[model samples]
Target: MSTDLPTRRAPNWLGAASAGLAVAAIVGEGFAIGIASDGGWGQATVLAWLVIVLTAAAFFGGLVATVVGLGRGAGMAAMVLGLVGNPLVLIWLLGALGTS
Candidate 1:
């Protein structure tokens, strides 16, 4: 008789990676904000695009982590910490761009 059963949660490393990606997304947003504020390369469309990409990745990644790795808590943290902060960052980014 087999005592070990398959686990429902993803591997520890994957959860950790998800968490890291979430954090990195926020860092990227900070860089984007800095640039948007004329603190760095102003009017850098490429960097703006990069930030948008990272934000999308974070949101999707966080969704996966939340669904498959929620047992580890990293997924939930990513959802709560990363997802919550992202919208405001995006709004601020847009405002800085004078889009809204």
Candidate 2:
């Protein structure tokens, strides 16, 4: 008799939800910063969109890795990347892009 345990996998819903939350956090922060920085609604919208793209890219990368059984590292990397990069990029976009 042979006994073996199957490898654990990342839950699709959990992964998807985590990514979604990350994106939302980034966008929400951008919105608040934009409004406070005199960006108005339009500028805030643009900032939010930028964050969305960044998060989407991270999500896609993580998803691919997860499918290949490398989700642990990839998901962690994605979360870290989003948490670190989002604020930095948000500040830059708000200040540099301006609301003109």
Candidate 3:
């Protein structure tokens, strides 16, 4: 007699969530840039906070998905986006602060 074992697949939702959050972070950063260009320090600061929060969420979510073996590619992409975006946001904030 021959027996077959079922293979387990990781949940795709985690990957999807991570990617979505990363995209949101990018959008938030764009808004922050616009606010900064307009010399709206208060608004820009608020938007910067939004960007930071979104990037953090994406990073943690991606890390969890990756460590859990759930959709490595999507998780890796999200993590990369978060890593790159976070530093850029910080630089923008620093420049804004210096100009103000």
Candidate 4:
């Protein structure tokens, strides 16, 4: 038998994409809050919904990346951000709408 070595490639971009999406989601939520505070409930509602959807997508995408042996650090960061950010934004949105 010949002595040989297999080469390993760098991880794919899913983890980075997940991280980017999570950061975007957080910014979107902040924008939604600002809009709501400015008496723009309609716009805020739409933005909040969009943020929620993006957060979910990022969370799942990160999980998939991690399982696929990609950038687990970035993926985990995205997942944690989604887990913490989504609910807080949702609650704030709900409270704002309820009081309006």
Candidate 5:
């Protein structure tokens, strides 16, 4: 007699959420850049907070999905893209630009 194990897969919803949040992080970063370039501290502060939240969500969500092996590509992409939009990094770059 032959025995077989059932197939398992990570939740699709989690992967989708992670990918979506990652994209949002990128978009948020773009807005931050525009606002900072225009010297809009008021808007930039609010946007910084938003980007931080999005970055955190994207990174963690993608991590979970990647570990489970579902949507690995999307999860990895999210992690990379999320880091690219990190608010701390943005602050440093913006400061340097302002100084220069």
Candidate 6:
């Protein structure tokens, strides 16, 4: 008889890729795409860009942690933090733009 041992989480390279793609999307959508549009952009748009940048950074950091053999939970935590930060950034951007 044979039994399988429990496996650790997959390398989760996707998490890193996810982070990179997210960054590209943000830059493409908010800065490049918006600026290239007919109407000019605003402070809110800039703020949205910032959020995406931060999220990208967090995802990279999480990837590093995972590569260093840190627990998957910690890596996931960092990703979650970025996810939480995203909406708040949008809200702040909206309020700031409105007041300006």
Best by TM-score: 4
How many clashes in candidate 2? 0
Candidate achieving higher TM-score, 4 or 6: 4
For candidate 1, write residues 1-100 as lDDT tens digits. 9999888744665446666776776776667777768856655456666655655565666677667664357766665556545655657777889964
User: Please, what are the lDDT tens digits per residue for candidate 2 over residues 52-87?
Assistant: 666766666556655554545646556655655575
Clashing pairs in 6: none
lDDT-sorted candidate list, best first: 4, 3, 5, 1, 2, 6
Give the residue spans of candidate 1 off by over 4 A. 1-10, 39-44, 87-89, 92-100
TM-score, prediction 4: 0.80
Lowest summed-lDDT stretch of 10 residues in model 5?
7-16
What TM-score does model 6 achieve against the real structure?
A: 0.38
Clashing pairs in 5: none
lDDT of 3 by residue, 17-90 (tens): 89888988888888888889989989988888878888888988899888887777888888888877884566
- For model 3, name the residue pairs that clash: none
Give the runs in model 5 whose Cα sits over 4 Å from its true position.
Answer: 1-10, 90-100
Candidate 3 residue 53 C-alpha distance from true site, Å: 1.3
CA error at residue 12 for candidate 3, angstroms? 1.5
TM-score of 5: 0.72
Cα RMSD (Å) per model?
5.2, 8.6, 4.4, 4.8, 3.7, 8.7
Per-residue alpha-carbon lDDT of candidate 4 for residues 1-100, written as tens digits (9 for 90 to 100): 9678887886769988998999999999999989999999999999988988889989998898888868888898888887767955668878988994
Q: List TM-score per model, in order.
A: 0.58, 0.38, 0.78, 0.80, 0.72, 0.38
Q: Candidate 4 — which residues are off by over 4 angstroms?
A: 1-6, 88-100
Off by over 4 Å in 6: 1-41, 70-72, 83-100
Candidate 6 lDDT tens digits, 1-79: 6698888765655455555544554554466445547555675567567667777676667666656745455666666
